[model samples]
Target chain A: MVAVDSHAYASRLRSWHPAEKAGLALATMFIALAAGSSLTEVTIAVLMLVMTVGLAGIPPGFYLRLLALPAVFVLVGAASAGLSVTGPGPGAGADFLVAVSLGNITTGFTAAGLSLATGLLLRSLAAVTCLYFLALTTPMVDVIWLLRRLRVPALLTELLELTYRYIFVLADLASQVRTAQSCRQGYASWSNSCRSLGGLINAVFRKAGWYSRQLAVALAARGYQGQLAVMEAEHGRCPTRAAWLAGLEAGLLVLAWLDRGHYLG
Target chain B: MAETVLLEAREIEFSYPDGTPALGGVSAGIIQGSRVAVLGPNGAGKTTFFLHLNGTLRPRRGEVRLAGERIRYDRAYLRELRRTVGIVFQDPDTQLFSANVAQDVSFGPVNMGLPPAEVREQVRQAMAATGVAHLQDRPTHSLSYGEKKRVALAGVLAMRPRVLICDEPLAFLDPQGQEELIELLEAESRRGTTVVIATHDVNLAYAWADQVLVMAAGKVIGTGRPQEVFQTAGIMQQAGLPTPWILEVYRELERQGWAAGGSPPRRKEELLALIRQAGC
Candidate 1:
């Protein structure tokens, strides 16, 4: 999360209009989901990877490392979905290719199940990459700007902005506590490590309570109303670029429709 | 001497919700266009008294008046009072709520209900004034402690308050950051805004402030020109405060008959000049 937050600020495209970036990434992801084809999903994933790593200048290795974080869960889910049980089948009559049999209960990978899992894995991955592109390219402040521009509820936007800012704060506090605990040999053993974690969590919650009071007083001093007013970034208008991105997304949709039945194979 | 008192609290008293006294019959008046420093040790009610001045905290006893009028407790009155007096709290982490620096600075002006263009201009000017214009796009958490402090000041200064109160404004700044903040506040003071800073650094209070208020426990033990108040050993001792460095040096020189001055120097260069003037 920290890496993504920092990288968004340093992105080569950080100065681009946030709405333009959100529109392209979100529209491409939706197309991938709705198209329901491996070609569409694969294309979307490839495009996003290029945008994040190639265009945005995030290191290819770091981008892969980030994607690999969720790959384990996705792969496990796919494997679970692909596995099937057949009632003492002699051949592929039960759609089972490879089987492990214990008496009359056979466990195997069915052709239909395997294809469904494959499709799901590709679809979800493409969706994940689309999100990564957005997260890696646009800072949270700008993202909130886009949401407010879209008229998302004020309460929700403020909550999100505050939560995002405090996540870094708490994470920093947690790390400092961990270091202090380790310096005293508190994490020298498994039992001590558990105890140290409990203490750290307790302190964090306590500090958060105190922090809110301070925040309220400071906000009041500055004449804060309930709504948090953020200034709009002047990226200026770029209709030509918008046209290009819209045309590109439209082309992807057309390609998805043309290759609609390829995944069924 | 003829300057109007911008803010005055007479017999103001307050206690924490836990029943501990935070202020006890504290009274002081801030003259407009004068730089005043509130000096005390920790838990000396400097902050509690500042809150009262800015209408953030109403005195449980006595009254706080602005421009000779008793402050009303109504929302509209308090809001108006806040517009004229802005207090930058000690901790920048608490004061800076927005993730973006420029946006954080815009909070005060936006709350003032200025038009979007004016708010933009205010944000721009505030950031520039505090030397954080380059960091306008930076995230709040990424800032150094000093940068955060400057951003916090910018956040308050954008409101264009007539009187600026900084609670321990020098608490966490580096020597350079402290120097920079003093320069910024001095500039604001030159613009005819009343600047009040609460600090434990007697040297800073002595060098920068024209008037000093000494607080002990929860009461103001003394208030006067820096020369007059620092000369009172009883008041300084009651506050657990030490005399400024230059003043002490000057006293030692005078006692030794090595130096004689028209008045005490406020800065090191002036002290050096004093030595030269004495032919020491």
Candidate 2:
């Protein structure tokens, strides 16, 4: 989470309008999910990867690693969808690509099941890449700023602002406590490590509560009147960039429509 | 000379909800446009007393006055008082709520309900004053401790308060950071804003402050110019604070009858000048 957040701030595309990036990501994701075609899904995934790694200038190795994080789940789910069991089969049906017979039952990879699995894998990965494109390019502050402009509730926005800021603080506190515990040999053994983990969690919670109270006092001193009002950063309009983004989205929509059943059969 | 008392606390008493006495009958006056340093040991009610000044924590028994008017706890009055008196808390992490440095600095001004242009001007000026204008786009978590401290100070300064109270402003700062911060505070004071900082550095309080307030046991034990307050042995011992080295060195020179016949030196440079004269 920290890596992604920091990278978002450092992205080359950070200066672009957040709404444009968000709209592009969400629209591409919607196309990938609704098209239900392997060609469209594959195109969307490749396009998003290029946008994030090439256009946004995120390191290619890091981007690949992030995409790999969700690949395991996709592979496992697709494998389940692709495998089939047949009962009382002397020989597996022609639909089976490879069959293994054990007693009266047989397990095999059927063509229809494999096709469904392939489609699921492509669609899920494409959607994930689209989401990552947005996440890697847009800082969370800009998203919250856009939300405020859209008239999102002040309470929710304030909560998001505080939560985003304190996550680093709490993480730092937890790491410091863990280091102290480790130095004291509190985690020398498995049992000891368990005890130390428990203590670290307890300490972090107590410290977080204390931090919140201190934050209240600090806020009060700053003339906070039940609201956290702050100026939104100015992101000047870029019509050329918007035009390019619109053209890209139009291309994706056309591909989704033209390749309606290219791979389904 | 009768100086205008910009902010005063008269026998203010307060206890925590757990019945722990944080302050008892604490009274002190801050002169307008003066550099006042609150010196004390740990848990000497310095922070608690500062909270009262900014109307964050109302005194249980006594009244706090700003410009000779009694402070009221009403929401309207507090809004006015807070606009005039801003506080920079000790921990910049807790004080800086916004991730963006510019946004954090603009919080105080935006809360004052200022027009958008004025708020922008205030934020810009505050960031410029604290030398954090270049860091406006940086994330708060990425800032160094010194940078965070300056950003926090900018946050308070954006309010354009008449009195700026900083709790332990010098703690956790490197020598350079400390020097730069004191210089910034001095500049703010030069602008006719009363600046009060609570710190444990006796040498700093002596050298930089026009008035030194020594607190112990939740009460102000001594309050006067640094020369008079630090010269009183009883107050120094009672507050568990060491005398500034300049004072000790000057007193030894005087005892040896080698010191120049003049007022005692309050700063290292002044003491050095005296030594240079005596050697000549």
Candidate 3:
């Protein structure tokens, strides 16, 4: 998670207008979800990967590793969808392409089930790639700023900003406590590890509370009056970049339209 | 003329909600345009006293005065007070709530409701002053400890407060980082801002502070010129503070009749010059 965050900050496209990137990702995602086919989904995924890795300068190895994380869950879900379970009766498994008897039941793979699973997997992955594109290019601060400009409630946006900042703080605190526990041999055994983990959580919780109090004091010292107003460096719209994004999305839309209802194995 | 007191605490007493006394009858006056160091061990109420200066924590038994005016807890008054007194907390993590450096530095100016252009200018100036201008686009969490400390100072400095209070400004910084931070604070002081720092480093307090306030147990045990306060062996021992090396060496030279009878040196160079003159 920390690596992803740092990569976002270091992204070559980080200085690009956040709205442009967000709009491109969201529009592509909408097209993929609405008019999705195997070809269209694959195109969306490829385009996102290119933008995230090639344009944004995210290393391909790291990007593939990140994609692999979601691929694991999607693979499991698609496998379940593809496998068909039928009754033990003689005619129950007639439609199954390949069947195996398991005690009182028969399970097999079916053509339609496999196709449905493939479509589901492709669509989910394409949508995920679109999100990763946005997350890898835009820092959370820019995202919060974009939300603020979109008239999201100030309370919600402020909470998001604070939460994003504190996530790193709490993570660091937790790791430090874990290290201290390990140094004291608190995790020398199974029971000891359990007790040590519990102690780490307790220590982090207490320290989080302490940090909150200190944050309040610090904020108040700076004249914080119920609002976390900050000045963001405005990024003016570049017609060239906007046009490029529009052209890319339009290409994806065309692909989606042509591939409507078309599925491939 | 005597220096005017910019901020004063009149025998202020405070305690936590659970009845642990944090500050007991603490009183000190920060002179305008002077660098003051509040030296104490942990839990000596330096942070609590700083909170009171900015109206973050109201005192239970006394009043805090800013520029001879009594501080009020009303919204307008508190706002005015905070605008005049900015605090950089001990930990940069708590003080910096924004996700990025420029946004964090701009928080104070934005809250002050300055015009966008003016706020931008102030943020730029503050970042430049703290030598963090290049890091303005960096994320807060990605910065090193020293960089974060500078950015934290930049955030407070953007407000252009008259009295800047830093809690443990030198804590957790490398030697080079400490030197850079002190230089920044010195620059701020040179600009006529009353810079106050809370630290436990006896040598730092002696060499850098124009005035020193030594606190032992929620009370100010000594307050005066650094030379006088640190030379007071009884108070230094009471506060659990060691004499600065320069002062100690100078005293040793004097004891051997190798130093002329005059005011003691506050810096290493000054002490060396004293010994050179004695040699002549």
**How close is each model in CA RMSD to the real structure?**
1.7, 1.5, 1.9
Query: Which residue ranges in model 2 land beyond 4 Å of their true spot?
Result: A88-94
True lDDT of residue B16, candidate 1: 86
Q: Alpha-carbon error at A195 in model 1, in Å?
A: 2.7
Model 1 C-alpha lDDT versus the unseen true structure: 0.89
What digit string (tens of lDDT, one per residue) describes model 2 on residues B1-280? Answer: 6799999999999999999999999999999989999998999999999999988888899989999999888898998998899999999998999989999999999899999999999999999999999999988998999999999999999999999999999889999999999999999999989999999999999989999999998999999999999999999999999989998999899999988567799877878888888899
Q: Using TM-score as the measure, what is the rank order of every candidate, best first? A: 2, 1, 3
User: Where does candidate 3 stray beyond 4 Å?
Assistant: A88-93, A102-105
Give the B-chain TM-score of model 2: 0.98
lDDT of 3 by residue, B39-142 (tens): 98888889889999999888999899988999999999998889999999888999999888998999999989999999999999999999999998788888
lDDT of 2: 0.91
Q: Interface RMSD of every candidate?
A: 1.1, 0.8, 0.9
Q: Which residue pairs in candidate 1 collide?
A: none
> Candidate 3 DockQ score?
0.83
Candidate numbers sorted by lDDT from highest down: 2, 3, 1
Model 2 C-alpha RMSD to native: 1.5
- B22, model 1: CA deviation in Å? 0.8
- Top model by DockQ, which number? 2
Docking class of 2: high
